[model samples]
Target: MALPTASLLAPGRVVPPAPLPAAEVARAAAPFGQSTMLPRGAYQDDQVLAWEREHLLDGWVCVGRSTEIAPKGMRAESIGRSGVLLVRDADGALRAFENACRHRGHELLPCGGSSQGTRAIVCPYHAWSYRHDGSMIGAPGFREVPGFDTSLYSLKPVRVEEWHGWVFVDTSGQAPDFGSHIGQLESVVERYDADALVTPVVHEYDVEANWKVIIENYQECYHCPSIHPELCRVSPPDSGDNIELEGNWIGGNMDLRTSAATMSLDGHTEGTVMARLDEVESRTVMYVAVMPNLLISLHPDYIMSHLLTPISPDRTRIRCSWAFPAEVVEREGFDPSYAVDFWDLTNRQDWAACEAVQRGMKTPSYEPGPLAPSEDGVYHFTQLMARAYQGQQA
Candidate 1:
């Protein structure tokens, strides 16, 4: 039977999805294999994102690599709606502050912008000047004001810390201590000597999907054989083991095919293996997701990172960078095209899948699904998120 043109041409309407229910939240936190996916509202609701911005991500979010800002350099970053300023002082110490000037709330540096060799942070609005350490230095037409103390007007401080060459900022002052937050990840990756490595390539992606969707994609290889043919050729889809750890993180490793050398397009590398890697470490790739916003992939010859910035309910911005040992990067005729191209292609594939999921979730018939045994990593992460929601409700 042929459908009428008028019926086909009519616009279809969809009712807005409801908020997450307590029952579903409990179901998502249930034991692995028994648990189902998080409720659709977790990904589709603006209110859920607002709660996450204030609780889950406001504290100890990874902003960028420490190497990006040189001595006397300053960069502006954002955590949800709040702005942050990262500074490398004259003494080479790293610091962070609220991006606003102490005088009139004007941003010292534009978001997503960087300044090098800066001597002072001067406000464009009122000419308030601050030193590299965030101490007030100059205040035009204010020194003589009654009881106006320069000491009391320094830029607001934000807790900053560095771990394995990555910079993290805590705006809420309520996150667990940095050490406890990092937990056993330090001992797990210490052999890589990540602090001594240098980043040589970075790529940004604006994905039309919830941040959690992208993370769920990274945690499991269930889709690798279908979407990432190149990756599957270099590493078996089933050759993975999830690690149990004590921290606000989740991770595991996958063994490389004996025929493969590294995770490049051709499964080979001209780069030298990291000096501290043992035999097993040299042949495996480790994937780690630090809570909130950082994803770290440790390879034998290089390290790759993905920093997530949630833009809206269905949008995220990702910063992906590749880091290699200094000696390997400085080698004559050294080229990183192999690694960069491989991941760039893989990343696009993942983004496409995440976008599809986002679109599907909006359909009226969409329902939460069960997790496969291979999806334990995803299950672990969802459990954490579900528990967080439960705690907030309580």
Candidate 2:
């Protein structure tokens, strides 16, 4: 549950947001035409930013990998307007909580490296120490204060769940079952044995574009023939097809031609063939978009995950990781530069396009344009956004 903002603020200083007029919200959620796009303000408005922080990012969203704060470490991360502390307790279980101190709302830790072997989360402001389980154990001078109760001040928890080693947090604790939300994806990826894949490389990009723009760019291939010459040559533009799925999930497969087995510069498989894939499945590439933050790409030889964190209405930080079979990555002299270079080059190209779109949207005359047949993914994505903002559950 969200904390009471009124109590946290000074007397008579908190101003509640006026409810949006029903007609305006209904218009905002109306389905778009084949040629129409969301209004430009949706990409760069202050109101939209506030709404997203409260409704979208406050729900289950990817923060980082489990290994980053496993066993005995504490890490700080931000999701929308919330500061989160990811902790691995003495019992060896992963947990998450609001980074604010229970007593005075001071940030418990600054952003950066994980603190190793941290036994408790201590607030520098008052030296109030909390065990890994978030129960308050020590509070200097507070023991002498009459009626003070440590039980009433245990750190507030943020609901957390892990999937195949990836960690996600839901600040509102209202998100549906994580497995049920992405079950279709798990069924398809189970064959690849992703749990056995070891991440050997991770890349970060600071994109000057709205988070939705980045996601929309990822869902379509209409620009492939023009912007991604190499990618299209290896996986033809016509090879892209959407996979039918249930719930808020969207995904599809792109066929790599007989001449191309991987997405590298030479279009050849450089790593060991993933076991269990048949001849046809061996050459196919799959893509899945987990709403709000994650974009997953599955290949015959490896897998890539993109986690998008929105910094503002027009800025996003994207972290990309490439994971390969443990056996292959563990091989001596193994180098993933071939696949990394290809994607690194493609990522730059995609970011450039997204940035250009952001610059264009700033024009007062800019308006939504018609979407091509290949942009069906973007259409589906916009629908999801509309529903989310209109107070409909995903």
Q: Give all candidates' CA lDDT scores.
A: 0.86, 0.77
Where does model 2 exceed 4 Å of error?
1-35, 143-147, 278-280
- For 258-359, candidate 1 gives per-residue lDDT tens digits of 998889887999688899999988999999998889999999999999999999989999999999999999999999988999999999999999999999
True-structure lDDT of candidate 2: 0.77
TM-score for candidate 2, residues paired by index: 0.89
TM-score of each: 0.94, 0.89
Q: Write the per-residue lDDT of candidate 2 for residues 276-323, one digit (tens) a residue.
A: 877766877888887679988888898888999888889999999999
In model 2, what is the error at residue 29, expressed in angstroms? 6.5
Query: Under the 3 Å rule for N, CA and C atoms, how many clashes does model 2 have?
Result: 1
Per-prediction tally of clashes: 0, 1
